[model samples]
Target: MTIQILSLRKKDLDKIIEIENESFVNSWTINDYINEMTHNPFAYYLKLIDKDSQEIMGFVGFYIMFEHAEISKIAIAKKYRGYKLSKLLLTDVIKRISLANCENITLEVRVSNIVAINLYQKLGFEIINTRKKYYPDGEDAYLMNKNLREED
Candidate 1:
């Protein structure tokens, strides 16, 4: 299947919310997405689409300020997991951020999410610190960072 990565748009939000709800325990509301799209000057988001079927398979969102960027969310649809699509999406995001002259990127992941932690590590992210009870459920989170400047 042919896939395309494009900037997130208003038309994609419904499918994004669906995937977000399926993937995260505390999903952002539609209003939250709208505010990010409309009001947040630093926020950036991208959607992965099945070009043939016009279906959104996944999305990634982040914010950039100065030389630093922070990943806010990423999710692939339940049916589309295990195909390395998350890797595809994340690698693209990193490349784009690097091109924008970002020095580093940071993201917080649930400490128990081994699969995600492994993926982040494979992408050159390192666990730099931990946040106690970072999640709404009181789960600890690992603060991971990828230094794009070092990669250059």
Candidate 2:
């Protein structure tokens, strides 16, 4: 399947929410996403679309503040897992953000999400800290970070 990464649009919110609901135990409300997309000046969101059918397969959202960027969310549709969609989406965003002079990129992943943790490590992220009971379900989260200024 051909995949194309593009800036997230208002039109993609419904599909994005569907994926978010299926993938997360505590999904974000529509207004939360709407506020991020429409009102948050620091936020940057992107969507991965199937080039053939124009279906949104996944999305990544982050906030860039000067030299630092924090990834807020990244999710793939339940049916689209196991295809490395999240990696593709994240790598693209990292590149885009780095180009914008972001030197530090960070994200928090559930402590139980081994797959995501592995992916993040493979892409040069290192676990720096942990947020105790970070999730609504009282699950811990590993805070991972990658320094864009580091040697390739």
| Alpha-carbon RMSD, candidate 2 | 1.1
Off by over 4 Å in 2: none
- Please give, for residues 75-134, the per-residue lDDT of candidate 2 as tens digits: 888888998888888889888888889889999999999998998999999999999999
Q: Could you give candidate 1's per-residue lDDT for residues 1-152 as a string of tens digits?
A: 99899999897888889999999999898899999999999999999999999899999999999899999898889999999999999999999899999999999999999989999999999999999999999999999999998777
lDDT of each: 0.94, 0.90
Return the TM-score for candidate 1, rounded to 2 decimals.
0.97
lDDT of 1: 0.94
Worst 10 residues of 2 by lDDT: 143-152
For residue 51, model 1's alpha carbon misses the true position, in angstroms, by 0.7
